[model samples]
Target: LLQGGDLSCVIRERQNSNKLFSEVQVLEWFIQLLLGVRYLHKRLVLHRDLKASNIFLKDGTLKIVVIVPGDFGVSRILLGALDFASTFTGTPHYMSPEVFTCSGYNSKSDIWSLGCVLYEICALDLAFDARSWVKLLMKIVHGPSPSLPESFSEELNHILHRMLNKDPMVRPSAAEILKLPYVAENVKVRSLFILTSL
Candidate 1:
């Protein structure tokens, strides 16, 4: 367990945090998560379930949050380098269309789920919602993709749209995502912080 706690606790600390993430703050969180995902991918692991509750944070110094993903109950390590994985796993709200349809999938599925997580972080609401399971599934498979508020920066909106692309092939790989302007810009800012601190 993370010494600080999970991100859900972080979200809970500020009642309206869901509605109030600055672009820089959200980009930093996304960069941290993408780095973690890149580590998992390099090791051929797939964190099938990636949501707010599943992400843990360091215990001390709550000012600068550190995300440590937890809950590996449903995660899997691929036996081969092909990257394809079985379907029908992961939480429905975060599940990609391929998972719902039992179509062949791969690590990109995790990207889809992460997109949903990022969206929730920014919007303070799940990307997909419905009164029932069937409707939820339908919404995920056929409903229009979720959109961010107009207040979000154009770059942030662009990256999120790519992340949430319905077509797995179209979504950026973790590595590719790490290279996006938004992510790269923050990485430099973080590096500057480290260097200056030293």
Candidate 2:
């Protein structure tokens, strides 16, 4: 959704779940992702790298093709990665700690990042902005994240909290998140609440 040109960091941050981006706008984008994940999980395709900046919005009101194919980060040609579950990869703001510890990771790791994405958009701030490899790794391993804003809907807060849980195996998959009531029936309404608050 950003206009083309080499992006300026300031402009990038402003677009990153900033208060001006409207929660509904964020939610709408998320809903599309959820649907995409649903189809992807069904195909046994896991995106591994998902973040606010990577997710794109075209019509601002489109859906049905939710997954935004062709950009699953480093997995584009591998069909999946070797040692896919353990390679420490992905962006810091949304990457799971396991992705860095060299512990190897998987689709579940992507779900965790998805949680960060949800949290970032609602807060209109990146979860963790690290400056170096060590710092980024340290943050993912032990940093406190951007907390759920006090004004958020209870359902949105709940969904985000659930996603952020540290155990990769325990984290819900996109398919699973989609089935949750918050994602299923009320993204529009709860998301609308976020938009109005801003």
Candidate 3:
């Protein structure tokens, strides 16, 4: 299992990165975003907390999102390729309600949250910031998903729409999403890039 250097080295270099949104290829960016998560699920792990901030690049040049162990202080537990989770946990704004209130959850919920993160990354705001977590969760469960802005790329908007599916079972798997056209494009793409998670 010989490769390059360690990931920490990459992390160190990434510290010098301006920001993920600046001068990054959309394909690589999308891959890193989803690959980071896919790597975890493949290891029979769930990120529990998948967000824009937590998902970071290593070398800032490889453009590959490598999943280490865990973040948010979550130690990655390699449980094999199983998809059952208990003792639910995750961030409120981006979490599947089941992660907090209910018992049944799995890697797919993380995918849903990833979808939310992608939506936020593209639109530059939290898609579900009603007033509080409770309000937001209710809205997510009862209200319609946030509509993609006309200003945003259609491909990205399509990907985001599929990710925000309320039913976890219906949400596209990260692997499936990585194959989308919006993700494969090698163009200079940019949106509002605003930060409101508000």
Candidate 4:
């Protein structure tokens, strides 16, 4: 059983308490998220409805936190490497541009959702907000990508931008994102931190 509850709950509690996550904490969660998504993609699974609320955290031994992606109600399994899902599914706030456009989407769509979750983690708010689904879709399709808070590192900002890119082709895949220097370094650092803590 997961002890820490969903990420959205954690973020909400922190926000209510006027406390924000440190950069290290955010990076650790983000890297864990990417690794989880990478594993899903490698297995030909598409978690179409990835959001902060769907990710759970468990307290591990030695105070380490383990992140798990859940809520697979809308997930699909691709039959081949080039396969894509056309049905519209996923939370509106975290939906990718292609998903909003009714175009076919692949694993990259999940990456876009990951970007939205990451933004929410940093800002404690949705990246795109509107009174109606129509306006929300318009903002997602034509609006400028939301910027990370000034306090976040520029490297993170860059990574978020890449994931939120309007063109799915331009967005980096989960594996590609994990290979990024910043993400890779964080993975290594997080590993060392966990190891030393134990």
Candidate 5:
């Protein structure tokens, strides 16, 4: 069992204490999340509801040991490479614009949700929020894309932007994202660290 609670709880606690997570910590979690999502995608699984509440941390010695994406209740398995899931499901703030159009969405939709999760990790708040569902839909479908704070690195800013692109086809695949220099270095270091720890 995971002793540490979900990411939402961690973000809430940090917000309550007026302490934001450091860039390194956030990147560590982000890379791990990408790895987890990439693994799922490799098996043709789409985690429809990718949100902070669904990501759990395994902690040891008061530090985040592992980041695990849970809650597969709304997930779907694509039968083939060309298949897509057309159902409208997932948290509004994390849903992809294409999902809103009811046209159908694939792995790239999950990339969009990953972008939302990354934004929340950095901003400690929802990337797209509204008082009503209609307003939220409008904002997501037409409003300008949200951005990371000025303090974040340009590489991260670029990644977030690409992941949240209005066109799903433009978004990078999970493997492509992992290949980025910024993300690749982190993944390499993290892998070594895990290896040494074992």
Candidate 6:
């Protein structure tokens, strides 16, 4: 039998009653996750199942852990400069518009999912929910873009808006996202501190 540890346990422990992460906590999560995603995309990998349950926390830090074989079942590697992946992939709640409509998708698809995850981190709720996958897809494709809590900084709201844009081409790449003022500053400082400690 398969034996393993998973992030769900940690998430449950940290988010008792689904408590929201504070701004500082969310920023820390964002910078570290952005670094991880940037590494993946630079190598042409698409982490199709990037949800809270798929992530593990250790020493107050998080890692994108592939819990099982089928856990990353939908992930793909780009064979060219761009890919038009036509199959519907990823969980319905975090799936992008193109994936829902089967129009085709690329790495930017992950950007949409990241936006949803970012919203969840600060709000402690899924960005969109419904009774069934079909209804959920309908909401994802047709529903207005979800909003972050009013307490979130405007910088985060603007970044999430671009990430969740309906048009995949319009969404920022992982590298571009890391270069954003908010992410760059925080991640840079964190990396420097780590370097000094080494």
The lDDT per prediction is 0.77, 0.64, 0.60, 0.85, 0.84, 0.78
Tens digits of per-residue lDDT for model 1, 19-46: 5666676777788888878888788887
- Per-candidate TM equals 0.87, 0.72, 0.68, 0.90, 0.90, 0.86
Candidate 6 C-alpha lDDT tens digits along 132-185: 878888888888887888888899988988988888889998899889988788
Name the runs in model 6 displaced over 4 angstroms.
1-19, 66-72
- Clash numbers, per candidate: 3, 7, 0, 0, 0, 0
Provide the global lDDT of candidate 3 against the true structure: 0.60
Question: lDDT at 137 for candidate 5?
Answer: 88
Q: Which of candidates 1 and 3 reaches a greater lDDT? A: 1
Estimate, for each residue in 46-117, the C-alpha lDDT of model 2 and write its tens digit. 566676555654444322222334544454222543436555555666778777666767677767877877
Higher-TM-score candidate of 1 and 4 = 4
Q: Higher-lDDT candidate among 3 and 6?
A: 6
Q: Tell me the tens digit of each residue's lDDT in model 3 across 1-198.
A: 013443333333444552333223434456666766777677676667676556544444223233445334542464555546676556677777566557577777888777776666544566788777677778767677786556556666676777777677777877777666656443223222223332
Off by more than 4 A, model 3: 1-27, 57-72, 75-82, 100-103, 181-198
Give lDDT tens digits, candidate 5, residues 46-125: 88888888887776212222222353367888898789999998889999999998989999999999899899989889
